[model samples]
Target: MNNKIGDFKLYLSHELGLADNTVMAYLNDINHFYDFFNNKNMQVKSTDIVNYMNKLKSDGYSIETILRRLSGLSAYFDFLIKERLIDKNPISFISKPKGWDKLPKFLNFDEVDKILSIFNTNDPLEYRNKILIEFLYSTGCRVSEILNIKVSDVDSKRGFVRVVGKGNKQRIVPLYNKLVEILPSYYNIRHTYFVKGRDTGYLFLSRNGNKLSRVMCFNILRDACERAGIRKKVSPHTIRHSFATHLLTNGADLRTIQILLGHSNISTTEIYTHITDNKTREILTQFHPRFRNRGKS
Candidate 1:
């Protein structure tokens, strides 16, 4: 089984082309389960996985963490089956733990507008900040993808920008006309103020003219959120969640969003549906016969 772990690592890293962080995370999850799996003499059953999941919950693992572990174990078992070691994927029919599909935290449209409104100053840096935030919401991209975007990656005339996502996978997401209209001013500012040496070619630049980093991205969003007076915690990913949720609210289909967001698995993208699920409850509760008389009294 340990040797199989090594093989799976290779499969994930080399064949799947997953990022190091993702590969490391999956390996960690598998190893964490291996300790208990050894007790079953490597002949693990679905009940064994259920018992393990219960143990995880009892030990206070968050729903998100437990779900990640289950996902990793499922993938590992799938790999084993592919190699003809396992007869079946034991956890295939297992239900996700309750609340595992809870809605992700995201800003409403008004909150996003408020955050964007913080860049009212004429300062070139402020323009850059506005562009960054808008770019994030417009693209629905990850921080890594945002940092990796180069000027060449954007094709304004075509109204699409190429983005590289997890596992170095490349996909094209549409660039809104609003973003296109405002890009030139930022480009001019970037060329004049930010650049001092050889250009890094990344679209978003720091004061040093290098590509905007993850920490820089975080600070930019945080500062904007503070200025906008949004009390809730926000990050680049919050903007991402906002992007997906807002799109869903506006009636974008999940498959289109999955492509735009560069999700390798549609299931990974389905988390955003929890918001629609809330809307679902609202509609159901509003019309249900059980609720019709309650407010009347």
Candidate 2:
């Protein structure tokens, strides 16, 4: 079983071309499943897989986690079947967990304004942090994608940034004039952090001249939110959510948002529709003549 799992890992890495983190996550799920079945001395079967999912739910795992584990198990079983180790894929017929489409949390424009305005322009680090926040909101790029951006990726003349997304997929995200205006100032300050030979082409760098990490970006936003008196659990993704939500609110079509966000599927971009639906409800309740005075009835 252990050797089979090892082979699966290699397959995921070499054949499937999954990212390192995704591969590790799948491996972890498979190992946990194997441990549970091994301890029970039970042959892996459809019923056993169902019991495992039940166990996960009993242990208070989230719907998302359970579904992700099931997906991993399904993939693993498919591999096992292909290798003639397993007769059938037990998880093949399992349905996706319901209520997994909960709306993502996003900040309002007022809250975003508070966060962006909290930084003092005189302080270089704060100014840089401000730019980071603005950039996240302006382009709606993922944290990983933005952190991987190089200085050369930006086209100031054309007002776009080339972002490398998941699976090394590249997309061009347009930059707003507001973001374009602040970038030159940021580049001037960014150069001062360069060491003699340690400097890299990354757009955002730490004082040590290395590329800023994902955690560093998280902490920057967390601190900014704290300073801005926002109680919501804000991260870089919150800014991204706000970006899409606001665009939808302003009548940006779903297909256009999909392109901007680099989503290959329109369904992923359709999540913003829920937010827009709620906003529509609010507008109708406040201003629509038929909705007025309905509470009196």
Best by lDDT: 1
Clashes per candidate, residues 3 or more apart or on different chains: 0, 0
Predicted structure 2: lDDT:
0.85
Worst 10 residues of 2 by lDDT: 37-46
Question: Per-residue CA lDDT of candidate 1, range 259-280, in tens?
Answer: 9999879998888887778777
Highest TM-score: give the candidate number. 2
Q: Assess the local accuracy of residue 164 in candidate 1 as a C-alpha lDDT between 0 and 100.
A: 82
Clashes counted in candidate 1 amount to 0
Q: Which ten residues in a row have the lowest lDDT in candidate 1?
A: 35-44
Model 1 stretches astray by more than 4 angstroms: 31-60, 88-90, 120-126, 166-169, 207-210, 264-274, 277-297
lDDT of each candidate versus the true structure = 0.87, 0.85
How far does residue 201 in candidate 1 sit from its true spot (Å)? 1.5
